[model samples]
Target: MVGWLIDAIKKDYQPPISKVKVGKFNDYVQREYDFDKLEKKLLGWE
Candidate 1:
């Protein structure tokens, strides 16, 4: 399921910014929102 989602995203998603900026944004969001926790929740672990 997660692999399919990632594959779909890779097929259909396009970022408006550069890879560096995307990485920075991901880091910021992870730090700000505890994204690992969010992922666990999404995967029904919490």
Candidate 2:
């Protein structure tokens, strides 16, 4: 449908920007303890 519309309109329609993939776990931290500030905050650390 989009291709047909583009062809009919004869206009260059730029597709939407691609999304950033973050679920691959490539940049994920395996150790939760590394986030000491968050752990402390959750533990009621002032």
TM-score of each: 0.31, 0.25
Tens digits of lDDT, candidate 1, 1-46: 9998899788996657655533554554333688899999999999
lDDT (Cα, tens digit) per residue for candidate 2, span 1-46: 9888978677676778999875875776666465788788889984
Badly placed stretches (over 4 Å) of model 1 are 1-31
lDDT per prediction? 0.77, 0.76
Who wins the TM-score comparison?
1
In order, how many clashes per candidate? 0, 0
- In candidate 1, list every pair of residues with a backbone clash: none
For each of the candidates, the C-alpha root-mean-square deviation to the true structure, in angstroms, is 17.9, 8.7
Question: Candidate 1 deviates by what RMSD?
Answer: 17.9
